[model samples]
Target: MAFERNTQETYYESIIRQGYSRRDFMKFSTYIAAYMGLETSAIGQVAKSLETTHRIPVIWEHYQECTCCSESFIRSDHPIVADIILDKISLDYTLTLMAASGHQAEAAKHATMEKYKGEYILCVEGSVPMGDDGNYCCIAGRSAKDLLIEAAEGAKAIIAWGSCACNGCVQAAYPNPTQATPIDKIIKNKPIIKVPGCPPIGEVMAGIIVHLITFDRLPELDNIGRPKAFYAKRVHDSCYRRPYYDAGLFAETFDDQNAKEGYCLYKVGCKGPMTYNSCGTIRWNNGVSFPIQSGHGCIGCSEEDFWDNGPFYERMTGLAGFGIESSADTIGKVAAGVLAGGLAAHAIAANISKRKELRDSIRTARENEKKFES
Candidate 1:
């Protein structure tokens, strides 16, 4: 059976029907606003929008992926985030979460697409396999590529969830037998928001949806189509061990005493310095901890082509405009050399000034002695 809903029902009405108080709704708004880096004034705006706006119809698609994105989204730290965005909201069709399956599921998806054409958000959770005439991955006897094109034609926008949908993840790695292709590559006309991670932070997933629901528009994106609010800073910039990195105190190995003392993990193949994400700040598992906090170095999962970038346990030797083969340790060595040279020059200049002072004193003494003799 198709899951039915009242098309005119607002989000707040649904929340209230679900037994959430106005206070709970406001609190959720505040929490989401904070996560979005919105000003305090915007909390009311967010609340107002959610209260009055009808829930957006979302058709979430699954393709060539591990389904980690779905796992992460449902396990969002905030119970209400999962409840409101996934359940109360008009998530009309999702292969993984919906009760309807087989023909019933297909019926639900097609109905939403036709009824809400150019309005419903098409959320794709994986990549499309383009190789072998798109035969590697199929759903309902159709290639993922064909289904994606059909769905995207009527979508208001597309949310490419996780690295798989954003950048083809592991399936698109070396030799890519399936030739997995990201949604953005397949859909050119639509506005696609890329949230890239092995499985992005659950709160981040919720925040993006809330942003869309609040503003009736996509959040401000960076150069690569990722939301700026969460991906603006590098993980290294907010990492707790940043001080150790600046002081050149790095853990040489995962089991070293320096690691126990909480030194920077840069030398042990930490990719935090190169990775842009909110992991250091927002954290994972309801703000309890993330990879870095758990003593493992960041694997730089958010960046494009991360699987092909380099070995996970090795630090990046160079980034764009950083000079070829120049690692952090090399830069530190050069900085130390410059500091030593500057100190030596300062000492030499001080010595020269002292000698000049001595010469002047002797000249004054000689003149005084000559004046007394005369």
Candidate 2:
């Protein structure tokens, strides 16, 4: 019994120690399981894992990024997610959240790496600069590349937390000065899950970790290494304005009547058609609203190299299936223009036919009068 007492605490035990009831723990498990896209049957499995498995060691490393991933993560709507996953978990090292710094922080990282080698998860939140012998970015007098290589050497898997880590983001945009490179590029041997966005949604981030914790394995990934559960459907599939797009109705401009009436924003440079993210379904700021819901286009922040995709206000031109030289704006406008022209032509023809009938009747009346006079 003393040996059992010395055993590592499971996730449920940790939370319960923090004053959460068993009912609350079960509810929290069910909630996170749903977020992980697990069915009702799997909720029991998730709860069991949380109740039995010890906390996995996590090493969160920062490179060249805005720390928005951490910012977004801490704002998760689920208290259990923020507390259990982010706060109470065995997160041995993180530049942003850790209390220690300098020598103490480096020692903690090394200790965890040594103790949990090949068992810990390494979460990278930014790009690694290789230019100038990696002089562009440094931490504790070591190049970003050296730190990444050392950390990734013993990690069981790696999770790239944002666009900066997954696809180099704006730092790797055209004419990259620092030669910022994504995690996948720098570390190729290990399994890497890329949760890409300018900053991905908070719940989605939690769901990925919950999936890892519950299943003790990685979630099914897409070709680009993102979780299929969240990135499977394009934002266009679940967009509220999809029917308008199908019917060819679109806002011609941002301030137009169609825009005010909640028409599709495809014409106004919305990237929902090409962007694969859960923003439309999951929303943001605790489901308050996403960019599209807030009257702005998606800007395709989740896609790779979105910074170089061209002007945000100008829609993509020359789409293969669109049949127009420009984007949805041109197609919608051209279709509307054609419809208006057809209506005008039809009205003119109808009036012409009516006038001819009137003239024929008048002639017939005049002829009948002449016949009667004769």
Model 2 CA deviation exceeding 4 Å by range? 1-7, 318-374
Candidate 1 residue 318 C-alpha distance from true site, Å: 9.0
Cα lDDT tens digits for candidate 1, 41-159: 99999999988998889999999999899899888887788787886566899888888899999999999999999999999999999999999999999999999999999999999
Residue 274 local lDDT, model 2: 91
- TM per prediction: 0.84, 0.83
TM-score of 1: 0.84
**Model 1, global lDDT:** 0.90
* Candidate 1 displacement at residue 317 in angstroms: 3.6
Q: Backbone clash tally for model 1?
A: 0
User: How far does residue 93 in candidate 2 sit from its true spot (Å)?
Assistant: 0.7
Error of 2 at 246 (Å): 1.1
Query: Worst lDDT window (10 residues) for model 2?
Result: 1-10
Q: What are the lDDT figures for the candidates, one per model?
A: 0.90, 0.87
